[model samples]
Target: MNQSATRLNTEELNLALNLLRAGELVGIPTETVYGLAADASQPEAVAKIFAAKGRPADHPVIVHIAGVEQLAAWAQNIPDEAYLLAQHFWPGPLTLILERQAHVSDAVTGGQNTVGLRAPAHPITQQLLQHFGGGLAAPSANQFGHVSPTTAAHVRGEFSEEVLQLVLDGGACDVGVESTIVSLVGDKPKLLRPGGVSREAIEAVLGDSLEHHTNQYTAKQRVSGLLDSHYAPRTTLITGQAARLQECIAEKLAQNQKVVLICQEINTKLDIEQFLMPSSPQAYAQQIYATLRQLDLQRFDTLFLALPPNTTEWLAIHDRLARAAHHRY
Candidate 1:
């Protein structure tokens, strides 16, 4: 790993902010994942992000703002639901879909009338945005349809030698998964995706019965993570009950298949291969991405994942695991 490519500081922040202001790309840290950030208000800078990620033009970027006050500046007709959600979840992993103000770029919104906006909880990101003095149009700091990068080193792995100017290393992400996406554009509140924030958490803050509509990703929706095959690892991922998954692992080992087992605990002592995550939910969430990234590099033929516990707290982990495994609905 290049030392310069994976580290940044306050001085680097100023330099990166200058690059962003001048319509150049910079990799930024966030609680969710590292993002390839550009000035959201600049069309040219936003286009570079899509080119670097090989992301589709129609796939919208989340405009990250410094604070809640800036929300009204970019988003129009902010609803009561948006306000409540923002008050509770801002500076965290929660992206809200709202109607775009006239001045907001269609490029940032992917030609949609509405745009996705977030106030990330990461201090480095907040400082960079505050210095830049505008929203940043950023997507996950990796190639499109690839596993999102949780660490700055992971971000550098995506680029060739000189494409990326700087990667602001802020260690591993706290929320290994993306933000919970809620759309406030419609009459009723809808969850576009389940993530770090639970639906129950959102309801607790709203203090009313909220209707959740299932808007399956269509060609027209252009929502993030809507693609059927995404968040994948190089190795084939098989998911099932812990016991059954363990059995599968044993069977594969008997056949001398190259297999790696990932779970919260390892009961059966199989010497073939295994990775154990912490038993607690918070610990599990924090380590999920880094674990998978490591296992993916080991040249394993298949990955056996023990299904996490069925509980609200495990929702985000389950979602990311299911996507990585590419299980049929």
Candidate 2:
């Protein structure tokens, strides 16, 4: 049985901040997704985040601040490139990995010498940070390795009230995905994750080409949401071009296998389990996770998704599905 978490108002938001001050976790809304947040200063509070989400100790979480004013305290040797990117994209969906400050915790950085930081673009979250006056180490508010929740209801569906003390309902996330993470700890910036901030947008500001990380995880590459088999549903998912996916579905039908088709363009007349998605990439990104969650609740044994176009606009969407299907880069 799932216990519904409370939706916070102004009064309740203050109460939620108090809970964080007491070293408790709260599900706070960001433009990306709901995040399980705790005071970044407290190692114990950060540890609870890993405990609640069942997140691996080796994988790092992002530290969210109110602004760049807190950068020197959280990160060291801040690069000129970091400042340029932050000026262009902070208070939006972008994460920067930089050389860890002397005081930053190993628990937050996954025992590494670097940390991920972002100033969220949500009003409630910004207000909370303002009142709290510190950083919050947060990851997506759901079981680790599962599809990320886009709304307060999605969070309630995932965990009971006891597990998540309070939820600040800022409604559904506008971006509906995680932030784009760039690692400035290297000689040049490398794209760790493709997300709301397009690579093209970042490169245009830098006046230099950016290196795209393949996400081949080593022990040292302890980045958030970079595991090979991540963002998966319970059922197997195979994704490719529309024609190829259709042929595969036909082959499965011949074997009398239980399958469901998820696509934007497909044969609607066919008598089979299907979920139609929006053709636009941004709209599709907004609903993709919710679609997978709802479809996974049904009796289908396999989920077949027709691939989106291979373009920069579709990069974030493709990155997500490829990981969901456990496709290596």
lDDT agreement of model 2 with the native: 0.84
Provide the overall lDDT of each model, using Cα atoms, as 2-decimal numbers.
0.80, 0.84
Candidate 1 lDDT by residue in tens digits, 1-329: 11223334668877897888889888888888889988998998899889888888988899999878889989999998898899899988999999999988877988899889999988778878777778999888988877888898899999864678877877788787888888887667777777778888987887765454333342235667756666777778888787667667777778888988787787666675678888887778777777777888988988888888989788767777767784421
Model 1's TM-score against the true structure: 0.91
User: What RMSD, rounded to one decimal, does every model reach?
Assistant: 3.4, 3.6
Clashing pairs in 1: 91-121
Worst 10 residues of 1 by lDDT: 1-10
lDDT of predicted model 1: 0.80
Clashes of each: 1, 0
Top candidate (TM-score): 2
> Candidate 1: misplaced stretches above 4 Å?
1-10, 210-215, 218-220, 246-251, 269-271, 327-329
Best by lDDT: 2
